[model samples]
Target: MIKRLSLISASVALGCIVTVAPVLTSIYIADEDAERREQEDLQQFAAKAVMRTELVTYQAFAAISDMEAPPGGLCSATQIAQFARVVFNYRYVRDAGAYGGGQYLCSPLSGDVRAQHLTMPPPDWRSKDGYLLWYRQKNPLSNERQDIQIGRNGNYVSIDPQSYVDLIDPARRPIAAINVETNTILALSPGADADDMLNAWKLAGQVNNEQWHYAVARSASRPLGVVVKSPRSSLVGHWPGLLVMWLSIGVVVGGVLGWIAFRRISRQLSFPATLEWAIARKKLDVVFQPIVRLTSGECVGVEALVRWNLNGRNISPEIFVAVAEQNGLIQQLTDLVLDKTLDELSKLLRSRPSFYVSINVSSEDLRTRRFLDVITARLQGTGIRPAQVRIEATERSFMDADATRQTIAAFRNAGHPVYIDDFGTGYSSLSYLQTFTIDVLKIDKSFIDTIAQDAASSVVAPHIIEMAHELGVEIVAEGVERDVQVEYLVQRDVQYGQGWLFAKPMGVNELVVWLSESSSTLQPIHQ
Candidate 1:
C-alpha cells in the first residue's frame, strides 16, 4: 500500500509537470512577451512608414527624373496637362511644377502662371542630391492641412503629409520616418521628439525601470525605422487572469491524475492505451492538401494528413506518430486513417477518375504484405480504384531492402504507384534509386526553398532534377510558396507541385467546395 501511494504521488507529479510546463514557462517569460509584442507592432509601423514614404519619394523622384525644363520655363504651361495626368494616377501628390529662383512656379494649381504666382517660403532643408524640401508646408489651397513640397532644378512634387502616417494608430503616438541618402531622417508623423525617438531607437528590446516598454524596428531595404514606447501594464493586463487560470488548471490536473494513478496503476493506462482508446472512438481527423499538375495547374490529387487530439489539446503528428511507431500501434493507426480516407474521398475520386490520393505509410508498414492486404480490403466497396490510391514511403522505408522492395512490388502490381516522399532529406544512398522502382519523387520543401537562393543547397536541386530526369520518374515539388519556385519547376518540365501556393490542408467539406469553386482555374491534364 505504501509503495502504491508513492507511485501515485510520483505519477501525478510527473503528469502535472508535463501538462503545466508551458504555462509556467509562459509566466516566466511574460516580461519578454511585452518586448515581442512591441517589436511586432513597431515592425508593422516601420514597414508601412517605409513603403508610404518610399512610394511618395518614388512618385516625386519619378516625376523629377522624367521632367525636363519646359520651353517656356516657370510661367508657361508646357505639357502641364501631361504632368497633371501622371500625378492623377498616383494618390500621394498634392501638386507638381517647375522650380527656379525661389519664387513663382508654373504648376497644375497655377492655371495662368503669367498672371498668378504661388510664392514659396525658403525650404526647411536641402538634400544632398541638390533637391529642396519643405516640412509640413501649409497648403495654399487649404490652411486646414499641410503637405511636403520637394523640388530640384526644373521640377517639384508636393506629397500629401497625412498619407505617410495614415496606417499608424493615432492613440499610440508612435513615430515613424525614412532615412534617405546622406543619412537624413525624414519624419513622417507630427509631434516627433528627435532625442526621445533616437533614445528609444537605441534602447530597443529593453524594459525601462518604470516598467515602460521601448522598441524600434528597421526595414531591411532602407534605413527606415519606427520607434514606440508603451506602459508594460497595458500589455500584461491578462497576467493575473492567466496566472489564476493556469493555477486552477494545475489543481484540477493534479487531482485528476491522482485519481487516475491511484485506480489505474495496475492497468495499461499509458500513452498506448490512450491512443488505442482514441482509435476505437474514432478521434483522429484526416485533412487533405491538394497536389496539382505544374503545367496545367489542375487539382490532380491530395495527400492525407492525420491529426489527433489528446485531452482536448492537439498532439503533433510528428511526436505522436513516432509514439505510434515506437509502440507498434502504427499499423492500427494507418488502418484507421485508410478507412476514414476512402470513405471521405470515395465520391470525389470516383467522379474524377483521373485524380488520385496519396497516403503516407510508415517504414514498418512497408516491411510485409499485410499493409497491401489491408489497403485492398479497404478499397473493395468504395468505388475507388487501386490506381486512384498511391503509396508514399520515405527513403527510410527502403533501408530494409528485401521486404520493402517486395511490398513496393506488390503495391505496384496491385496498380498503386509508389512514391518516395521527402526523397533527398533521408538515407545516405543512391542505391535506393537503383533498387526501389518508385514512380515519383516528392522533393522535400527544404530543397525547394533553396531554389534561386545563395545557400549551399541551391546547387543541389538542379542535380536532383537532372538525376530524376535520367531515371524517367515524374517530379513533385513540395512546399512551393513562391512564383519563382513554380517558374523554376515549370522551366525544368517537372510534372506536379504542392503547397500553400496552390491550397492549404482542409477538411472534406472544404475540399469539395474548393474544388467546385476553383474548377475554372484548373486545366485538365492526363495523369
Candidate 2:
C-alpha cells in the first residue's frame, strides 16, 4: 500500500510538469518576443531619428554653403534676403545669417534693421570643415528650450533642437537623441528625463525589465545616440489565465499523454515553421467570396481567398501568404491556391461559362513568368476558359512595372482578365496606372467605408472613381456592406461590387449550394 501511494504521488507530480511546462514555456517565449520587438522598434526609431537629424544638418550646410562676404557686407539687403530665403527654404532652420563682431549681423528673425545679440556658450566641438557646433544653448528667438547652432566661416544657422526627434511620438514611446561624445541630450520627447536617457546610454545594447524596458541605439553616421523605453506589454495579463487552464489539463492526464498534447500545442504555437511544413503537406484551406454584379443583383464571380486552420486557430491569408513569400514557397503556395480553386470550381465554372473565379498572386509571382505559364498550362487541359479564371493582383505586385507588365500582358493574351486590387492604397500615380493595361480597378474597402462619412477621407472614394474613369478602366468597389455605398457606386457607373452585403465568403460546398439557390444564374452553358 505504501509503495503504490508513493508511485501515484510521483506520477501526478510528473504529469503536472509535462502538460503545464509547454504552456509556461510558450508564454515565456512570447514575453521575450515582445521585448525583442520593442527593441527592434527602438532600433528603427533611432536610425530614422539619426537620419532626420542628418537631414537637418545637411540642409543647413546647403543653405549656408558658398556664402562669402559680399561688397555689401553682412547686413546688405541682398545678403539679408538670401538669409531670409534660407530660413524660408530650410524647414528645420529658424535663424540664418552671416556672423560678424560676435553677433548675427542680420537675420530673417531679427529683421534687416538690426543685429541680434546671442549670448551663446563656447563650442562643444569643431568639425573638420572649420565648423563650430554649439550642442545646446538657450533659444534666443523662441521659447526657453535650447537650440543647436552651427557656424562656418562668417555664416551660421540656428536649428530647432526638437527637429532632431520631432518625428518621435511621445504618446507611443519616449525617445531621446544624445551627443555621444558629450553625453548631453540634444532633444527628448515627453515622458523621458535626463536620468532615463543617461542610464539607457550606459546600458546600451543591453535589456533591463525591472522597472521599465529600455533600449539604446546608436547612429552609424555620427557621434549620436537614441534611447527608447516601454513598460511591460499588456500580454502579461494573459499569462495567469492561460496558466490556470493548462494546469488543470496537465493534472488530469498522465505524463506520456500530457506530453503528447504538449507537442501538438507547441507545433501550433510555432506557426511560421509549421506553415512551411503545412504547405508541403497540402494542408491549406481555400474559401471563395463571390463578386456580385451590381445592376443585375447576381453573383458573377468569386475571389479565391486562402485560409489555414491549425488546431482551431485560423491563419489569415495575409499572414500565411507573407510567410510563404519570406520562405521562398510563394510560387508553391500560389500553385496550391490556383490548383485548389480550379479543382473545386472547374465543373461549376464550365457549366456557367460567364462566371469567373479570380485567383490572387503575390508580388513575387510577377518577378517571373512562372505564374502565368502555370495558370495557362492548367487551363489548357481543363475545358474552362482562361477568361473564366481571372487573375487579381495588388498594386505592389506591379512594383517592377516592366516585368509585371509583360506577365500581365501574357495573362491578358491568354484570355485572363487582369485586376488591380486594393487600388489607391499603395503608391499611386497616372504613371503606374497607364503604364499597365488592366481590365478592372478594385477600390479598397477602407475607401468604401468612408463613402457617406463627414470625414475628409470620404472624398477619396469619389476621386478614385473619377481617376479610374479618366483612365478608362472599369471600377469594382470592394467591401460594399451598405445600400448607400451600392447606390453611390451604381450612380457613378461602377459596374461590380464584392463584400458581405451580397454574400459572405463560403466553402466549396456552401458556394455550390449558393449557386443552386440562384437557379436563374446557375443555368448550364451547354444546356
Candidate 3:
C-alpha cells in the first residue's frame, strides 16, 4: 500500500511537472521573442529619428556654407553680430559666430563678448574640418546654466540641443546622440544624465550584464547616431501574472492525476465504479427504437436502450454491461436504466397510453426480490401502467430455469408482460416456451437476415412464427431492414417488427418528434 501511494504521488507530481514545464518554457521563449522584437523596434525607431535629425543638421550646415567670408580674412564685430542674428533666425540654431584668437568675435545674444570666458574643444576637434562640440555654461542671455552645442567653421553648424532631445518621447526610455570621436553626448532626453547614460550604454554592451537593452543606430550622413537604452523589466511586465496562472493550473492538474493514479494503482478503478458514479450523477441516457406492427405499419411500442456517455466518449453497452454483470453491479445499472427510461417516457406514455416500452433484463436482475421492488417503486406515481412496460429476457437469462421461471411468474403476477429476446440465437429451448407463460418471442436479426434469401435458410423464421402462434404468443421480427423482408413478415402474420427500415434508435427528445411526424403516414393495412 505504501508503494502504491508513493507511485500515485509520483504520478501526480510527474503530471504537474509535465504540464507546467512546457508552459514555463513557452513563457520563456515568449519573453525572449518579445525582447528581440523590442530591440528591433528600438533600433528602427532610432534610425528614423536619426534620419529626421540629419535633415535639420544638414539645413544648419547649408546656412553656414552659404555665408561669405569678411574682407581681410576676418569678421568685424558688426558683421559677426549680423551673421549671428541671421543664423539664429533659422530653426534649431541657437546662436552662431566666428571664433579666433581664443575668443568669440561676436554673438547675437551677447554683443562684443571679447572678455567673456568660453570652453575649449578637445584637441581631436582641430583635425576635423567640421566638428560638433558640447559643453555646459551659463547662458549670457538667460543667465542660467545651459547645455550647448558649438558648430565650428563654415563646415559645421550649431543648433539647440533641445531640438534633438525633444525627439525622444518622454514616455519612452532615455535616448541620446553621441559623438564617437570626442566621446561626448551632443544631446540627451529629459531625465538622463550624461555620465549615468554613458555607463548604461557601456554596461548594455557587456555580454555578462544583460539587464539593460541598448539599440544604437549610426547616421550614415552625420557623425552622430541615436542610442536608445531600456531596462529589461519593461519588456516583460505580464510574466508574473502568467506564471501564477499556469502554476495554479499545474497544481489542479496534478491533484486530478494523482487521484486517478491512486484509484488505478489501488485496484479500485473499474467500469462498474464509473457506472455507479454515472448513475449517481444521472449521466445514463435512454434511446428508443420503434417496435412497429408489421401488418398495420404502425408503431405500437419502443425498446428502451441504455447508453453511457463518459467524459464525452460513448462507452458501448456490450462492454460496460458485461463488466457490470461480472462485478455484480448489474442490479444498480438496471435500476438506473428503469428510472431513466420511465422519466424519459413519461410524456409519451401520457400521450399514447397504449404504447408499450420494452426494457432488457439480466438473469442477475431477476434472481433477487429487490429488482421487482425497484420496478414496483418506479411505477408507483407515474402515468405508466405495469401493462405498458414489457420485460425482455434473453434465453441465456433462463439458464437457471427455476429462478428465471419464478422471476417471470412474479412479473406476470404484477401485470408486466415478459418476452424472450434474441429468440433464434440463444439456447433455442422448446421447453422454455412450454414451461414459462411468455407473451412475446422477438425473432433475432440473424434469422430475419436469412428471410427471402434462400428457401432452406428462410425456413426457420416461418416455423418460429408458426410455433409462436401455436403458443398464442405474439412475434416481433427484429432487424427487418428491407421492403421485401417487411412483406415476408407481414405474409407470415408476424404481429410486430423493429429495424432501421422503420426508424433507427433515437434519443427521448428525437422519439417525440419522430412519433409526431410519422403518426399520419403509419396506417392500418385495412385502411
Candidate 4:
C-alpha cells in the first residue's frame, strides 16, 4: 500500500510539473526578453502589406488628381477619358472614372465581363496589375473603334472591338456609374455575382462589403489605393505551429496515462520534489495593466493579473490554474489574489475614490457560499463601495448558464459590477446578456489586434459593440496596441480601452509614482 501510494504521488507530481509548472513558468518565470517575437513578426508583415496597398491606391488617385486639364470649362469628355486611361495605366487602380450625370467618360478595366452564370468581379481581382487597363477605347458617338487602346499594356493583346469592347451600345445604357460625392467609381464586378456585388455596394460599412476589404489611402497627394491581398496559402502557414503545440499536448496526455497504468501494475517510490517545491517555495506576484477611458485618456482602473513567481523562473497561469483547481487549492489561491489585490487597491483608492479595480474570479468562487460571505465581509470591513470593484468572469465560467446567472444576480444585487471578460472567446451566447446582469463586455485582444486592418473587425466588432450598447452594457476594448487600433475603436464608439498602449503592469510604489507624475498629462500614445 505504501509503495502504491508513492507511485500515485509520483504520477501526480509528474502531471503537476507538466501541466501546472508550465503555467507558472509562463506567467511568472518565462523570458519576457523573447516574448511575442513571433506575433510581432506577423504583425509587422501585416502592417507592411496594408501600408504598401494603401500607398499604391493613394498614388493612383493622386496621379488622377494631379492630371493637367485642357483649356476648357470642364475639360472635354475626351480629355477626361485620356486622364482616366493615364491613371488606370499606372498599375495600381483597377480602373478610373470621371463620369457625371450617367455618362461614363472612360472605359472601365473590364467591359461587360461575366463569370460562371453571374456578371460580377471577384473580391480579390486587383492583386495583379496585368488586367488593370486592358479595355479598348471606342468613339462615344458611333460604335467605331478608336486608335487608342485606353491604356498602355505590357503584353499587348489586340482587343476585339466588334465582338468585345465596342459591342456594348453606349446610347442604350450607362456602363459604369460614379459617385461624384465621393469621387469613387462604381462598376459591375465581373467575377462576383451581380446581385451580391450590388448588395455589397448598397451595404456600405456592412458585412462582406468589398470596399471595407480594400482601402483607398492618400499617398504623395494622390487619392487612390492599391489592394494587397495575402494568399490563403500564406495564412495556412500559421497552422504548423498550432499543430505542433496540439501534438505536444497530446503526447503529454499520453505520457500521464502510461504513467498511471504503470503505477497501477507495479508500485514504485519517487520523491514529490516538484509539488513540494511548488506548494512551499512558490511566490505569488501581481502585474497591473492600466485600463483607461477612451474619451479622456484617463486611467480609471487597473486589472490585477496574477503571476506565479518562481525562484529562478516565472510560471504560466495555464499550468498552475489547472493544477490548483484539480488539487482544490484554487480557493486558497483566489483568497491570496483577492487579499493582494484589495490591499494594493486600498491605498490607491484612498487617494482616487473614482478609481476602480478589476479582478478575475474563478467559477469555483461563484459556486461556493463561503466565497460570497468572505468577499462581502471584506467589502464591509474595508469600506470599499461595491461599485468600485469589478469582477471579471471568463466566458468558459459563464458556460454553466444556471450558476453564472445566479452568481451574477447575487453580485449585482449587492451593488457589485460584473463584466463578461474575454468577450469574443468561448461561448458568446446572447442569452447571457439577456439572463445575467452584465455591466460591461470586454472585447478580446484578438479582435482588437485586427482593428487596424479594419476589414476583419469593421463589421464584427461594431456589431458586438452595438449589441452591448443596446443591452445598456458598456464596451471596453482590451489589448489595444497602436494609434490606428485606438482610433478605429473610438470611431466605433467603444467607451473604454486597456493594454500596453496605456501602461504596462507596475508595482504599487511604481504605480503611485506614475500617477503622481503624469496624472494630468496622461494621453493616448498618439495624442
Task: Please estimate how well model 3 matches the true structure, expressed as its whole-model Cα lDDT.
Answer: 0.70
Alpha carbon lDDT at 68, candidate 1: 60
Worst 10 residues of 1 by lDDT: 176-185
Tell me how candidate 4 scores on lDDT: 0.54
Reference-based lDDT, each prediction? 0.72, 0.75, 0.70, 0.54
Worst 10 residues of 2 by lDDT: 518-527
Q: What tens digits encode model 2's per-residue C-alpha lDDT throughout 157-252?
A: 888877776662454677788878778787777667878678778777465555567666665445667777766674556777876766666576
Residue-level error in angstroms, candidate 2, position 20: 25
> Between candidates 1 and 2, which one is better according to TM-score?
2
Q: Top lDDT: which candidate number?
A: 2
Worst 10 residues of 3 by lDDT: 118-127
Give per-model CA RMSD: 14.7, 11.4, 35.4, 16.1
Tens digits of per-residue lDDT, candidate 4, 340-459, equal 778877877766778888878888877645666667888776767777777888776776778778878888787778888887554333435666778889988876776646242333
Q: Model 2, stretches more than 4 Å misplaced? A: 1-270, 519-527
Off by over 4 Å in 3: 1-269, 524-527
The clash numbers for all candidates, in the given order, read 0, 0, 0, 34
Give the best candidate by TM-score.
2
Error of 3 at 78 (Å): 99
